[model samples]
Target: MGQALALREDFDGSDLRRLARGSRDADQTRRLLALAVIYAGGSRAEAARTGGVGRQIVRDWVMRFNAEGPEGLITRKAPGSPSKLNDVQRAALVQVVERGPNPKVDGVVRWRLLDLAAWVWDRFGISLSEATLSRELKALGFSKLSARPRHYAQDADAIDAFKKTSRPAWRMSARRSRPAPR
Candidate 1:
């Protein structure tokens, strides 16, 4: 048979249980609980089952707990790729969004993902896809909005008068040319 599973000599079953009970992190508490079971002379398989993980995982947890104490059992953040834009750049981008783009200079009447992507590339030298730019813009509190199309010479007064005088087609009374049969 392989070497029996065990915890560090310094930590006792009660100490492990107390740490497990006091821990706020669910994962950490689970690891501590498994360690407690192992320390109490329970089989490694039994401890793994109690911890709701595989036997190998419990073994790894025991090794970590023994080597680095309670902190080792806690979950760590997975390192992710750094953002393309820094805080200052993000803030500047937000400001640029808030101050509407100039139509004459930018050659665009309203903002679009393609236009924003081009602008970002030109200003910051960072090329981003339309979808990426869209997500970033959304994160900066900007949303996709398009203005309704209307003629520049349209008169509001005429529209109001038309609305006031017009009757809906559905509301028209049916008129019969022939008299009703007796």
Candidate 2:
């Protein structure tokens, strides 16, 4: 039920126990609750009420149980595509980064993700996508480092003098402007 009450109905057959053994998903738990309520002589409405799902869903599971029993409660997995990189490739990539600076191609010092991906494919012969490679690096406590422009006042005295003398007097500008012809 939506509200918690301390009513203990006569539940049987360890359906909930076995469902708990399978997976901790909400669907499996709901199915088990439905079976427990209805199979133990509780009404379809009462089953839905106790299980906190709609009456029709409870009735459906009851019908499914009647047809296939406990095995009927098994939930199907969500369909999807498979992953790209395997454990071995991930390990090799991580090792290369942790070992530090990459070899010079044309004299650029450090390695980027594409460079790492290329190196990984060349050395270990395992092609890892840049996205997956980034995830692996983050999981291993590595973060991207970048540089910011620094304002280094090398000669503060010279800079201060330049700023002070940089402006022309208002009187000088006024003197430089020729009056409009009458």
Candidate with best lDDT: 1
Against the true structure, candidate 1 reaches a TM-score of 0.56
lDDT of 1 by residue, 1-182 (tens): 67854678998889988988888999999888888888888888999999998998988998888789999999999887666877887887787677768999998876777887788888899988888778777887778887798899999998887785656658545578556889
Candidate 2, 1-182: lDDT as tens digits: 45322222333546555664675667767778666665566776787887787876776776666666566767877786555567786687677676766456523357688888778777777778888778778876888975554467577677677776556656545654878778
Name the top TM-score candidate: 1
Show where candidate 2 strays beyond 4 Å.
1-29, 41-92, 102-107, 147-182
lDDT of 1: 0.83
Task: Show model 1 residue runs off by greater than 4 Å.
Answer: 1-32, 41-80, 164-182
